[model samples]
Target chain A: MIKKFTSALNLKSGHVDLSHGGGGRAMTQLIDELFIKHFDNDLLRQHNDQALFSVPAGRLAISTDGHVISPLFFPGGDIGSLAVHGTLNDVAMSGARPLYLAAGFILEEGLPLADLERIVISMAAASKAAGTPIVTGDTKVVERGKGDGVFITTTGVGIVPEGVNISGNRASPGCAILISGSIGDHGVAIMAGRENLQFETSIVSDSAALHGLVADLVAVAPAAIRCLRDPTRGGLATTLNELAKQSGVGMAIAEDRIPVKAQVKAACEILGLDPLYVANEGKLVCVCEASAAETLLAVMQQHPLGRDAAIIGEVIDDPHGFVQMATTFGGRRIVDWPVGEQLPRIC
Target chain B: MIKKFTSALNLKSGHVDLSHGGGGRAMTQLIDELFIKHFDNDLLRQHNDQALFSVPAGRLAISTDGHVISPLFFPGGDIGSLAVHGTLNDVAMSGARPLYLAAGFILEEGLPLADLERIVISMAAASKAAGTPIVTGDTKVVERGKGDGVFITTTGVGIVPEGVNISGNRASPGCAILISGSIGDHGVAIMAGRENLQFETSIVSDSAALHGLVADLVAVAPAAIRCLRDPTRGGLATTLNELAKQSGVGMAIAEDRIPVKAQVKAACEILGLDPLYVANEGKLVCVCEASAAETLLAVMQQHPLGRDAAIIGEVIDDPHGFVQMATTFGGRRIVDWPVGEQLPRIC
Candidate 1:
């Protein structure tokens, strides 16, 4: 079957055209040579519109996210890796073991075949490394000017272990707030890659899958961890505010305790942006019982992705749900959620 | 909590801006008043990055589709209904009853809030009518000119019944081929909606959810049904060719027996397009045992979505796997898979 369609695709020099998304012979050839060849699995090999499989009886977690960063190729990561890491982190935040993924691609006509292939290869590598397979997918094409290079929407599903109850509304007073690593790396990296930006830095996107670290944390303290969130689009400040509002509590943190790379701080200062509100692809905020803070901090520190982990703040009993920061000058100020995004298309 | 953010949104006069997708206060406000208000469910109300729920032990089917149809509105349907029906139909093609959906939206900046709300309402109505609730979702905003009006990607999960097997590769020689209703209406409607088309017709899109009809068919003849497919995208000819190749058999159908609306045919002729290669939204092609064809046909005809159901073809023993159609003028021609899509972005 593949032999009959291999001649239709010119992977070396061809560009995506209207026929590639026409749901005809060209589309089949593309799916066969590029997608199926890379994402080969028994379920996907069935050539059915949907993949069928059995699941164990347990709680399931589902998440979906769209990736449309301006620069397809960023400093530390590209849109492909970000798409997978973003959705997988969302599922893992629920203390679920990530299992399967479904991807949808919106490609602009006339995109280089080489670039598309590179993105798919990167996605396949990321999914394989994370132990999640993309089982089913769909592709659509628009006119040249109607779309950017490409946009990917990934949806993931995972199973939560019994007795594990993690949610955004589970935080309460006396809970300890901890961050996995330094913030502002991803947002600053994206900004540096933009054409108008004239800054140089070694800071790279913190776009790594956190399911492994999450699995380790859930193994040690399933009940102690109250909630988990990854600071993505609106960064740390927005995430904390959301948690505070959702849990109906307040947060107090010492500014000196939060970890921020010097380069990121310099970039933020120059750009007039707040590091607290910049995005981080691979960092997470964990709220756990105050008693388990030390143990979880040690556990996180042992992991490569969490070497810079820190216990930055604590939850408080306040009806107003204000997040306050104790400045280095020994004064307190409100860390309000920004009205709008300072950086657009930061992913 | 809602009172504090009520003043930020002016739905009647405002347009989507970068702030709405920035994951900031504006994003939260939009979500609270629009998405959460309409897609209100227990899982979504949790306000977590992911939705967690328990599922029964069984075989699960998952599918994803991207809808980027040009001209947000058409004759009978819009992008919202197409987004829901397309993915739901993909799941139903496996003889599964769809349970839940996850939606991801990429909104271009400057799009009217009213348009977004209307699309969301239509989507919610379709989901409710089909009994498939959207449990999780994410929104991203792109710069103006970087995207069309909006693109929606919907992912669905359904449960396949035990002891039932349906796949594209399950067709065998002597199997009966059945279609649910008329074809080409969707593609013609979209083409008519595009600019510079001077034709006038009352042909409305056949965009609908067909899971209810599929459920009735499965209940009556689960084991007898060999394969199922929805003739979307490249339409009936492409779908038939794909099934023939997958099942390693040949197909023989009479062109006169396959139902095509008079208006749709007239439009196709005027545009130099073949009705067999045009798209359909609310249709399905089923392959079943020759002995059980009558019973399944009766069951499908009783359903509202399948009043024009007909068995217009049969599988044959041919290694070449060719699909041959007998013309109304007493001639046989090879119904080859189209080399490219005749109508792009028709959904």
Candidate 2:
């Protein structure tokens, strides 16, 4: 017989006060409606203070991310869904099967209860869709004016299949570089939502979990794939530069080969930002042997999340560790790391 | 052969701007001097874009914590150490062997480089002592005034021994309760350090890792132990109340049996605060079978970190799940959950 300890809560129209984050009845209600509803699974349904589960035999990959972006509700998603996707993508970058997550929230005093519920619901939905459950969590409240609305920190655990030796340093010369989707969508979307940067057109953030796409790629070209990286905060340019430095190689690309949506490109130009440096939360950079590049690209394109996949560049042995792209005008220039953050509070 | 990457930074000491948190030379230097230097380990030295390590085969427990304590540096430890200890304790509470950690930093613009260095050193020391290393991390900087000086979020992963089942809901009727060391030391220590309090006393915050003591308890009384909890934010009274609610049981605690240091008790009395609601970073609450209570108490007292350990309470089946304490005057009163945060950022 199943015994339900906590009752369902009416989360709509509720405003979160200091008490909500205070580990009392208010917290229990929030967990029941917003967290448990979406992440509902046997492990979480147990209602124990901690989640207990067994891991199948394999190497494990664990990653954590904290989401404190201002304006809890953004164009694409709220802090809740972002928390699930951020850590899930982190584990997925290791070519692993993300299984479970632990979340800790530091909610500021006086945040509307409705907003918290909305965020939590979104998080639950995201976790459910991604096949990961938030089994254990903690809630803490900070004094009024001492914190932003709410900050969520998520820790994810995943299992990597045996014999999958993948790392940023594993990229070898002649490996093909492919991007899962268009660049700069997430950063531009967030900036557009900001009051100061309100633009004419709406641009939603490309925030998502990429484990499914990764699992598909690994199935087809496991040995050929050298590395996988989700181009986040610093974007594709910074990611490629880091990979170049790590692998002791250089990268050459044709500007025409990279995919950039028209709206994103125009937004970047208007804001004086390079599309390459802007973030891409849903997109991933995969480095694979040239022999298996087409197979991986085909698999990525078949997935709805990776429909805009493109073969962007190729790796080359270069001690200088340069990342260069050829312009449509037939000229070439070095793509250096961005001097500073392109957009702040972009996950 | 070993390689060294150290340089004298050109920027002035106290003038950090938006670019410092950018993933570039300044950020690299900040990580190299402040974070990497203190959190040095072979896994971090891999210098790959991510940290990779081997996990032993076993059940796993994972936890994450976001440290947003104001005045980044506190009485006994700063946000760095607090971040490490907070998550590590969460993992240890599951009766697991804590192994690795990942840290994320949200740095506000204009934070002094020197201060970051101090916090990083504290984190390094805490990790070294706990036998866990921060293997991977991400850093972001918010504009000045938009955020406090620094916020640290740490995530930890651990391996649970087979057949070890420890949880908050495991408390049963006739279970004995044990507390580690003096309570309210951390809360009072911070209160004394506050400029508004203006009370001068020699009460240092009890901010130490409890995994060592947990290992000791598990060694001698593994099967008898039901639950282990760190009395952190809402302190002993709140923690006991949570246990009671989770386990659907009532608790009877002796007020005189609960250990409180002279300084903490005096400070609480002077401030019109209850030491029961005050925080204690280094202390923990253990629940076990009543028959093995004496043996567990003896084992806890033998450890340096648990010298003041005492059996403070017992569990009873109750419909209302009340936590009542017997006063020294032979009167019994209900200890209710705290309504609001008594002292913010006391952790």
Which candidate comes out best when scored by TM-score? 1
The lDDT values for all models are 0.91, 0.80
TM-scores of chain A across candidates: 0.98, 0.93
Off by over 4 Å in 1: A6-8, B6-8
Report lDDT (Cα) of residue B120, candidate 1: 88
Q: In candidate 2, what are the lDDT values of residues B1-347, reduced to their tens digit?
A: 11123455533476567766666555656666666777987666554445556666668777766777655776788888888888888789888878899887877788887787778889988998999999887777777765677778787878888767898888999999999888999888878777788687888888888888889888887888898998877789888987887788889999999999888888899999999989888888999999989998998899998999999989987878889999999999999878545767665
iRMS, all models: 1.2, 3.3
Task: Please list the residue runs of candidate 2 whose C-alpha ends up more than 4 Å from where it truly belongs after superposition.
Answer: A1-14, A24-29, A41-50, B1-12, B47-50
**lDDT winner:** 1
Task: List TM-scores for all candidates, in order.
Answer: 0.98, 0.94
**Model 1: docking quality category:** high
Rate residue A109 of model 2 by lDDT.
73
Q: In model 1, what lDDT does residue B116 have?
A: 89
